[model samples]
Target: MNVLNTDVLVIGSGPSGLAAALEAHRNGANTVIVDSFARAGGQYWMQSKYGLERNDRQMQAGANFITNSENLGIKTITDAEVWGILPKYRVFIQQGSRDSIEITARALVICTGAHDFVMPFTGWTLPGVMTAGAGQRYVKMYGKPPGDKIVLAGSGVFLWAVAATIVKAGGKLEAMVESSSNQFRLFSLIGRHPSRWTETRRLLSPVLRSGVQRLNGYRIDYAQGEDRIEAVKLRQVSNSDRDASQELEMETDCLLVSHGFRPITEITALLRCEHQFDTKKGGWYCKTDPETGATSIDNVYAAGEVTGVTGAQSALIEGALAGLGVSEKLGFTRNGIERKRARLMKRQLRTARFADGLAELFELNTNSMPRIDDNTLVCRCEDVIWGDVLKSWDDGAQNLQAVKYWTRLGMGRCQGRICGVAVSRLLANQFDLDPRIFGFNHPRLPLRPVTVNVVHDALARKSL
Candidate 1:
């Protein structure tokens, strides 16, 4: 086995990872960055090639910030998917071509960001149906169009930005269904986080000009078609409390659905770090001191979406804080930049947490998902269905763990990374309750998919 040593390894090349690496490098600590995607910007730059007319600036900023940081001694590992973290800060990374790497660092910053939350529908498995992130990536990175005529259906800032991207890509948007509880309620919060106003103005600028029709109070009922998505049905959502009413249905060829993102906290949970199940941040977010971004695990710091889904702004600040803390802990701060970086990071932290109303709307609730029948497919990777989960419930499967075993639900190539929340919604549907009342089974670590060979190698070299 080969070994690569660094003073700090910051995972994920998005805004957060970029800031962290920049801070660490500026503080005179050796730092490397990695992400599964090919480029530096995560969502900001790559959401859609036809981003909102105004999004170009931010994406450019993110790209420049990261590339510049990389040029200044930040090692970058593009197209690398990390498998797991060993006990002694060894990060096992698997590149896209299946080549593996073992990265041993004195401190680890988990800037691995969040993914879009998908609650399945009858025809959601169809071709035209995808998460908002996927739809954006189709145009942004791959140079493909979402479709000629499309409907952007979901909540949060990403949905609006994606809608604009579609319009800018020369694709016609038929409708946009928003699940934001009430944008008016948080009007006061916008002041606290000044940066949000800037981001919001930028994201919404293009969509407003695109002339895409806005469907204010409707949720996607299902995508209906045989081979691929040909039409989407929508129900008029009632006031914030209940599901959509069956009066309204939008006739369209494609439906892009995403209600923001939940925390990718499975690996964090596996570490047995203390977590507080805040229904506000979508799912369970890591409970860390806001200042250091340090979790309960010693020398194991989390940044970006793995800690919580606070958008690019929050991720950058948190990553910088973690980077400073890690450098100080590892004695890389002989130049006194740690104190300065920490102060700057803390100031930016408050700027990012500004009145994010998306947090209130997108909670871990089965009620938010489109109606699921007993035969509906819940786990896309393993082909597990609602019937299988319900059958487990019928056989006395009480909690999420029992649900997982009875249906072999979470056992798959990607593990339960994607479908964990969807299955939780299915289980909560079995009993009539909000998913927050009882969330998914506590996330066990080794968050990414790992092979036996990687484990053996990591264990053999754990003493670094």
Candidate 2:
């Protein structure tokens, strides 16, 4: 195997990754960035491959980061899907269309980021039902609207952004149903965290101007269609009387739903880093030193959404701190490094306060998900339903491991990334146990899907 060594290896190209790479390079370290996408920007600044029009202010911020990183002589390798990482900072990356090489770093910065948190609702497995994030990507990145008529439903401010993107793409939004009450608490937090004010303004502008029907305290009860989603059933969330919870049926070609985001902790978990279960942090996050972003393992630091679901501003600031911390740890430091770290921490804290408020306001109401009937599909990859999990539980499966063994719940192509949380939620609700106790499915080598031939070739090559 070809071994490429670097002083620092940053494993994402988003705002956080870009900042880390730039800062580390500035501190006199040989740094390289690897991302799964074709471009450097993460989800917040996802660029269109076909050169789509972007009016959102977030795009400019992302462009600035990209430009700064390029000017600092930072090297970025796009379309490199990192499947595995070993101890002593060895990274196994697969880029079949290009060169597949293994990377070894003196220090590692993990900014793997987060993915859409989708709680299973009735008919969620339907073809026309997608995540709000996916809808945004379709409109902004793919340069195509998801459908002619769209219904956006979920928590968080992200849905509004998705709505805006659709409107910008010249698609009609039938309605937007959010579970939150739009209370004053979230509004009050915006005042304290001025860093996010620009983004907040940009995301809300299109929605306010589009005049889309906004249902403040409503949640999707279910989606109904045979070939594709034609309509959705919505219920008023604030109503105390279940029967009086006004039910409305709205016709739509697509239904986009997302609760929030869940951090992609597979790599950190595989590294045996200690993690803490915090719903507000977007499920399990790698526990790190807030001052340095260092994990339990020496020379291994985590930044960005891998640590938590705090927004882009916090991610960028934390990345800078981690980059500086790595530089100092590697004996490459400049004057007043401590002062810089302190300033970054303060900024991170301010952004985090606003993020926390959003998380609280748009927290995934586990209660909002309609009760899963026996036939309701829970694990999409394995095609396992609620009945299958119940059967495993009945067969002396108490925790996730035993359940997985009996039902093959997490043994599918996704490697339990999607189904693990759903399984945990189901087990917790059924047994009245803490969801964290089940932990996550124990991670193994070859974290992502790889071709059989590629795996065989990798095994054939001797370790350096």
Return the top candidate by lDDT: 2
Candidate 2 lDDT: 0.82
Instruction: Write the residue-wise lDDT of candidate 1 on 1-464 in tens digits.
Output: 44688988887777777777877787788888888887677766553334432446766676567658756867888878776666777777766654668888887777767878878778888887888888887877655567777788866667877876666666778878776555455445665555568677766777888777886656776778888888887766654545536556666666788866877766666656676665456577777767777888887778877777777767877777777777777776656664676676667647545524557644434434576677778888888888888787789987777777888777776577677777765566667766665555554445566566655665676532
Best by TM-score: 2
Encode model 2's per-residue lDDT on 1-464: one tens digit a residue.
45689999999998778888887888899999999987889888787765553455577678777877888788888888888887788888877543557888998999999999787767888888999998988877677788888899988888877887888777889888887886456657777766667777777877788899888777888888998898898888744554367789999889998888888988888888898889898889888898888999899888999898988878889889888888778988888888888888887777787778788888766556543678888888888898999988898988888888888888898888888887797778778888889887668878888666555556677542
TM-scores of the candidates in the order shown = 0.88, 0.95
Q: Which residue pairs come into collision in candidate 2?
A: none
Off by over 4 Å in 1: 47-55, 184-195, 239-246, 334-349, 352-356, 361-368, 429-464
